[model samples]
Target chain A: MRRNLAIVPAFNEADSIAPTVAAIYQWAPDFDVLVVDDGSTDATAHRASKAGATVLRMPFNLGIGGAMQGGYIYALEHDYEVAVQVDGDGQHDPRHIYELLDHLREDPELNMVTGSRFLASSGQGFQSSAARRAGIRIFSSLVSLITGQRVTDPTSGFRMTNRRGIELFARDYPHDYPEVEAILLIHAHRLRSCEIPVLMQPRLTGASAISSTQSVYYMVKVLLAVFVGLFRRRPIEAGDRPAMAVEHAL
Target chain B: MTKITLQRGLAIAVTLGLLLLVFELVRRKRLSERYAILWLVAATTLFVLAVWKGLLTSLSHDVGISYPPSALFAVAIGLIAMILLHFSLAVSRLSDQNKVLAQRLGLLAQRLEKAEERSADARAAPVPGKRSALPDHSEAEAEAPVPAQELSTRR
Candidate 1:
């Protein structure tokens, strides 16, 4: 009954999606793949479907946060035991997906596992642009200070969530600059999380959606979002939650 | 006409015009009654201030503003700011709902594609005496999953 789902949120990545889907199926054949095509004008949905993955075509672009939330809702509705997020741009190595799953399986208490390139011994293969690196560093420190958990790559899209995490996100999720805020939300929900070293590949095609000039705006907006999250009321009540099934290992 | 009547008359006219516009929009079903309340309240307040010149003058004098006409401008600016703030709130709520709708659409679309695939597979082959469960080609496709495997072979 250990059903697993790999949620790939792609936006106009026609060139990279086919291989990315192939890589995912090859690396993790047991998992069912759901590609949330984020309103790509190009042939992204067609290409993904051809690549042997279930494609969820958005009528209009809903950014990363909305797309991923849709994936979580699907997972929840389908009763997927675990849902892992893998970027469709081919930046995240699906080979490391097993490692993330392993961390989640090994610890039933942990609700999430994030793939971080900057984790100690992570090999530091492809550090992003200088501006992005600095922004990540600042966000990492800010999130760490608030959550008391040292997150090396707060901006990493490569992450996995359990049933608890999925339900929490399906109810409410950050719409803009989600990765970092999502980490904070996980902490707010009092869910456990861990990060392991994972290699990040350079984007196979298309420049980053966030341009160099937008970095400043990105920083300010993210910082504001994170701080606002600290004061906002917690969505889930701790008292009324049902106890999770305790299992030793997968 | 004196300066007072010219300025006050124009203010009253504009306020009345706005009030009438709101009523027209609501009548045409273009503006919701909920939003019309804000516009109605704003226009009514301005009309009151424009018609009662003494209230405007006394209020400005009590507030230590030397000029009475300037008070009308001040109140109008303040009301405009409040209306803008209300609009900002409405836009934020609409965007949040829009995101939820988009998410639901994506999920439902995926489910539809899957159903389409299953029916398609059922129709591809027929049992020797039994009719194809799905007679309609379009219907089968609706229930069947997209033929992703076929596209993979093309490359």
Candidate 2:
């Protein structure tokens, strides 16, 4: 039996976490939901627990990267076959989780599958502000250039990773602007990645952590981080080097 | 004594004051011995250079500087800059350590919560024939750990 763990990284989404947890339970009961409350000042942990989700309360806010890394570590420790990350603001619909899992299940070659909001055929929902979209576009282009793979949504947090992907991220994940760099990291580790079309809903409550003004700064920093990843050696084991390197070498 | 000697005397006095301060800080445990060593070396070097006036004159002549005191000022500035740079590097290391500590604390807190929950569940469950529902509560506690972030060093 393939065990799936749903990892929700929430920061002060008390208003929206309940319904999100409920949606996950209703839509994907097969997957065990774990909400990592990232030192929320609100009732996020309480509401998530009441909604029947396992709540892991962080002592303080480690940002989104920290929370997701914690989830990955939990998944790795619990021997979960796969772990899917869902945002707590209810932007990522739980229904699409099955779509991502479907790809990972059907193809043994794939290590990770991400949900993209900007697919042309997919209906438009909330695409965020123009500045943020522009930033995402730049990141997508950069990731595509490096990985030799077209990625429409490099910044999407709604993604699923198999055991190998979970283990890699559990050991080493970017502390800031992880989504885009994560794609590059997966490539560096010789992991296969794919993207699926999924519509993003409007945020349920609370403003985005990155404001409009900070979008430019976010883009520059993420680009710098990704650039640094270009020079980074693959995180593969020594004995299996030639095979993995040949497969992923650019 | 000449005007240069007066200035030299003041510089020596200031160096002595700073050396005393570093010693006092080390004695009070306000500054760790590791860091105090740097400050001590800096102060002692400055004191020696200030007292050795002939060395400064000869060094200034060799360096093509018209004024000997200018060379003294230059050496003092250069030494202070190097010390400041070393302090910056130390601070950077401390900051990285602080980040790791914060991350570990958060992960440990999560584990503690899980252990408490397991024990609570074990206590609340209906036992039959002295067999608890959670048979491996201690085992769970022992294995409870969640890593916080990418612990791997960046290239």
Candidate 3:
């Protein structure tokens, strides 16, 4: 079996880190869980360590992008064949990791497979608030239009990536509000991505980083990032050997 | 008139003071020579304009500004804006470097921890036939606290 790594980026989620780590281990025993303690003031690192997950402690908070990049870097260094991103708040279901992984393995062309809540017609899980949903819809439409791909949930962080996706993200990722732009990045490099239906639950503990008041700002910032990303030069060739060389040099 | 002379004196003094301040900062190592170059150019331009009254008047007239001191003020503001923009770019670069440093630090720290654990485990259960002088040296080292600081620096 290909080595799988679950990268959980947690910020002050001591209350939920243990359970989240344990659940991932229980569901995906074959996959190794890595909890990136993003400079949490609480005992998040200790709790995650106690839960039997390898903990990577950042010297300071680098937000989600930096934290996840740290995990990708680790994945690259350890030569993991597949990398899964699971949120630390226990909102993302650990059971769905296999489904995402299967999708990646089944499709040779697909570089990334993201778990989307809106993909299913039954709506069995927690769909975000109406306003946030509207924001997600706007992003979904924009990303789809930009990439010429159908992306129902661009904001879904429950994603699995192959070595190529891991290399791209580990090299360059947006600092804030990264998930939506990540799809655009994959497309920029001519990498293929798709989504699968997955059930998501409301966060178990603390309030969301993006509140109602910050939603408008978040929307504008992400839209601007997506627009600006269009102007960035794509460096990878068709073969992707240059990227591998750069990674090796690093 | 005495009023015009006093104004000229004040302008000369201020520009000279700025030039001296920049020199002092660079000399004391508070500011890098790279940044000091911009300040030095700005202060020198202001000093030249201050001492040369006819040059300022003619330059302001050429720029279609009736008031000469306002021209000086405009130039000073433009220079300051450029300096601020330069500082902003520097800050953005510093932050990018800082994030990379933090990420690398975290990754290396984790690697160090794993190495320590592996060494500890090896010490805990030494293979009978595998034991050698090298293993004894490592065991002695493991008995003492791991010199994590030294190891990190070596990397």
Which candidate should be chosen as best, given lDDT against the real structure? 3
TM-score of 1: 0.87
What's candidate 2's DockQ score? Answer: 0.19
- RMSD score of candidate 2 (Å): 7.7
Candidate chain B TM-scores, in order: 0.75, 0.75, 0.79
Look at candidate 1 and tell me the lDDT of residue A179: 93
Residue A88 Cα positional deviation in candidate 2, in Å, after optimal superposition: 0.7
Q: What pairs collide in candidate 1?
A: B115-B143, B115-B144, B116-B142, B116-B143, B116-B144, B117-B143, B117-B144, B117-B145, B118-B144
Q: Candidates 1 and 3: which is better by TM-score?
A: 3
DockQ of each: 0.35, 0.19, 0.38
Candidates 1 and 2: which is better by DockQ? 1
State the TM-score for model 2: 0.80
TM per model?
Answer: 0.87, 0.80, 0.88
- Predicted structure 2: lDDT: 0.81
Model with the higher DockQ, candidate 2 or 3: 3
In candidate 3, the residue pairs with backbone N, CA or C atoms under 3 Å apart (3 or more residues apart, or in different chains) clash, namely none
What is the DockQ (computed on Cα atoms) for candidate 3? 0.38
Among all windows of ten consecutive residues in candidate 2 chain B, which has the lowest summed lDDT? B146-155
